[model samples]
Each structure stands twice: as structure tokens, then as C-alpha cells.
Target: MDVLSDVMTVLRTGRPFAARFAKSGPWSDHRIGRPNGFGVQLMVRGTAVAVTEGGETYKLGPGDALLVPHGAAHLVADSPDTPPGPRCEPGHAFPGAVLRSDDPEATHVILCLAYELAPNRNHPLIATLPDFVHIPADPGERPGLAGAIAMLDGELASEQRGGDTLVPALLDAVLMYLLRALLGPRTVECRFAGWATALADKAVGPALEAIHAAPARQWTVASLGEVAGLSRSAFAKRFTELVGQPPLAYLTSWRLTMAARLLADTEAPLASIARQVGYGSEFAFAAAFKRDFGTPPGQFRKQAPACDPGAEPFRREAVAV
Candidate 1:
């Protein structure tokens, strides 16, 4: 699997939630507090003003997107002076709530998304992201993000036959595009130096792919360096510089992350999971898991919520503004 896909597979928990809203006139501002997860706001039409927790304000126009990666409290309003109203409840649906204005031309449409990430297993890629990321709606600037927003807007606007199945997939695609837009070519030379840069490097990228592809392999610095077509010392230094950790350190973390997923999602035996994540024996794996997670694997499995096979893999709900 690709790096982003692999990271998301390990870090994402329950199904993501999303919604679209149609607002007209001068409405009371909405303050959203996501707590442990992240929230996304996209302006599909018209314009709005966004204020971060630190009082930073942004004017978001059509096609613009905002990501609250740290789950901070934020306000979205028709104008910067609009006072925030009551907190919106999760899963609340408002089809077409009338605001302060009845003018059809004053309507401001928005798409909102929420994601629940694994709190315990924070990946380097995610850790490297800032508290908030804003992507302006420039059609020719970042075509991927613009295209995703366009597709999502169309899908949400129309009542299609397979929309129930299609929208969730499209939301996931939009998320991928958003991340790509944030960590674009400009980030390679400055700012981001961890997983973002590592994934962009031709040499380090292949080595990371190899490790993620086969966590069970008995990998060494020399072996990984060979995969990157570099000498051991050079590869080690480069990997450390870009990935923000030694290769072995990252490998161990990845193995444990995979083990955590298997524990939560499957009934695989502890010994089996250990082997899958490259541990030689159950005892060793248990010790390592305890050290990393501060809980035994069995206990962790027992405490984790069971994955529902019959439920939708991705759930989305839209609220009217």
C-alpha cells in the first residue's frame, strides 16, 4: 500500500462523518469544538469568515477548505463580527434552516467533515501537520483539491442512485487530496522535514514502502539501506534527518501500530499478531506492546470497541446552516 493509505489504515478509528449546509442571510456564528478528532469545513458557495482558537481570522470564499487538525474550537460566521451561537451537536441534521435572510442570492453553502483518529498511535505524518491548514479555492492553483471539491459539491447537490455508497468514498478521496495539497512541492524544500519530506524523497520513500510492505521481515540498517540503494551510514543519517527517527525506531513503532489494529479489528491470537508484526515469540511481543501502549494486548482488545461488520464503513451526516 502507499504511505498515506498505510498510515490512515492504522490511525483511523470509526467511520467519518460529513455534512453540507445551506445558509442565507445574516446568521449567528457557529462554534465547533471537535475535541479529540479533526474537523473540515469547505465553502462550496458564497463566502464566510473563520476564526481559529488563537483569534486568527480568515475569509473563506467559494471552493476554499479549512482543516482543524488539533480539534480546536473555531467559529464560522457570515461576517467576522457575528457573535457565536450555541454549540452544534454531533449528528444533527438541518435540511434547509432559514437564517436571518430569505434572499436566495445571499445563500452560503458549505460542506463539513469530521474524522476520529487514533489518539494513542499518533503517526509522524499527522504529528507534523500544523493546528490548522487552509487551502484557498483557486481552480488552477491546486487542481487535485479543486477537482475533489467540485466532485463532492456535485455529489452532495444531486440525489443519485448510489449516493449512499459513493459519497463516503468521495469524502475519503477529498481528505487525501487535502493532505496532498498541504504537503505539496513547496513543503519539500522547507517547513515540513518529517514524514512529508521522507515520502517525497525518492531514496527514503522506497525504503519506507519496503518497511511498511513487510513489517515482519528481519530488517537491519544495511538491509533497508540496500533497499534505498544507499550505503548503511548514509541511509541511516538521511532517514533520521527526514523521518525524525532512526529507521529501526520507526519500524518498531509501525509494527506496534499494525498490531494494535489487528487487536481491535480481528480475533487473531496474540502469538499470531506478534509474528505478523515481526516478534519472535508471544512473550517478547507482550513486553514490547506493554512498553509502547502501557497496556497488555489482551486488555487492550477487551477494552476496545468491537468493529461492527454490518455497519457502514464510513458514515456521513450533513447539517444545514
Candidate 2:
């Protein structure tokens, strides 16, 4: 699998939640906050404005999309001056709620999707992103994104058979498109060295895939350089420049991340977990784990909450329109 897909597999938890808002006339503002995850907003029609908690305002037009990666509390409104309505309780929505303006000419429609990530595990790629990633509407933009939005709109508008199974899958596709759009070559001028740059780099991308594909392998600078088709020194410099860390340092972080996942999700013994994460012995792995996580592996596991692998996906929730 590619680097983005692998990262999603490791970091994402539960299915995504989606809601649609259809309104005519002036609409009361809605505040959305996702403490445990992130929120994505798409303008399907008309116009709207999003005000971050920090007082930054972003105007969104039809076809525009925004990613609130930090889940900051924000206000969505038809205009900047619109007053916010009562706070919508979590997982509850008023039946037949629709916002109407005094003027008959105003109309707006929007779609919001929420994705839950592993709360305890903070992926480096996610950390590098800004508070928001905005993709403006463009007539010549990638058609796949528009098509996905259209399909999602259709699914929500009609009572089609198998929609329960299909909507979640479509939301997942929308997320992939959003990430791909954000990481596209056009955004290569990003200020910081992060996953977007690392994934796009010719040399670092392959090396990253290699490291992820074989976390248990006894890889060194030379081996990784061979994978990247670079000399050892060149590979180390480029990897560190684009990924914000030296190759070996990144490898250790990834290994420990995998070990933590195994500790939480599986019943494997500590020695096996150590071997799987490339440690030579239980003692060495425990030492590293303690240093990195500030807790021993056994205690970490004991304190971990029970994980329900078969938990239901995507509890539907909506905001008052």
C-alpha cells in the first residue's frame, strides 16, 4: 500500500459521520466541535462563511471544501453577521429543522463529514497540517472530487436500497479525495517539511514505503538508501530535509507506534511484540518503550481501555438547520 493509505489504516478509528444542511433564506449559525476527531465541510450550493474560534473567517463558495484538522470549535453561517442559534446537543437534531431568511431569494446547502482518529496516537503527518486546509472551487479542478460530492448528494437525497452500506463507503472516498487534493503537487510550496512533501519527494517516498512494508526488517542507512536509489549520505540528507527527521529516527518512531498498537489491540506476548517491532530483546524494547511513552509495556496494556473491534460504524447525527 502507498504511504497515505498506510497512515490512514494505522490512525483512523471507527467509520465517518456525515450530515447535510438544506436551507432557504437567512440561516442561523451552527457551531460544530469535534474534540476527538476532525471535521470536513463542503459547500454543495450557494455561499457560506466559517469563523474559527480564533476569529479567523473563511468565505466558502459552492464546490469549496474545508478541513478542520484540529476540530476547533467553529461557526457556520450564511453571512458573517448572522447570529448563532442554540448549541445543538451532540448526537441530536431537531426534526424538520430548516433555516429561512426574511428575503425569499436566499438559499444555501452544505454537507459536513466527521472522521474519528485514534485519540491517543498522534501521527506526524496530521501534526504538520495547519488548523484548516481549504480547497477553493475551480472549474478546471479534478473531476473526481466533484463526482464524489455529487454521488454523496444523490445518496442522501433519495432512499436507495443498500444506502446504509454505501454512504459510509462514499464518505471514505471523499476523505481520500480531500487528502489527495491537499497533498497534490500544487501545494508543494508548503512552509514546513511534512508528510505532504515527503510523500511527493522522488527519493523519500519509496524509502518510506519500504520502511512501512517491513518494520521488522534489520534496515540501516545503506539499505534504505538503496531503496531510494541514493547514496547513503544523500538519502539521509533528503529524508531528513523532507520528513523533518533522520531516517533512523523516523524508523524508531514508527516501530514504537506499531508496538503500541499491538499492545492495545492484540493479545500477543511482550517478547513477540518486541521482535515484531524490531527490538532484539524484551529488555531493550521495554527500555525504549518506557523512554518513549513514559510507561512500561505491561502497565500500558493494563491501563488501556478495552477495544471493541466490532463496534458499530458511523452513528448518524445532524445539526439544526
**Considering every candidate listed, which one attains the maximal lDDT?**
1
User: Model 2 lDDT vs. the true structure?
Assistant: 0.75
Please list all clashing residue pairs in model 1, or write none if there are none.
19-318
The window of 10 residues in a row where model 1 has the poorest summed lDDT is: 94-103
TM-scores of all models?
A: 0.88, 0.84
Best by TM-score: 1
| TM-score of model 1 vs. true structure | 0.88
Worst-scoring 10-residue span by lDDT in model 2: 94-103
Q: What is the C-alpha RMSD of each candidate to the true structure, in Å?
A: 3.8, 4.4
Per-residue error (Å), model 2, residue 312: 0.9
Please give, for residues 225-320, the per-residue lDDT of candidate 1 as tens digits: 999999999999999999999999999999999999899889999999999999999999999999999999999998774333225533333344
- Over 1-321, each residue of candidate 2 has an lDDT whose tens digit, in order, gives 667777876666555556677777466556567665677888988998888878899999988998888676788888888887555322224211211112224387787776666677677788888888788876467788888888887676544577667777777788888787778753364444576788777788889989998988999999999999999999999998878889999999889887877887789999999999999999999999999889999998887543332345344333334
Cα-based lDDT for every prediction: 0.77, 0.75
Q: Total clashing residue pairs per candidate?
A: 1, 2
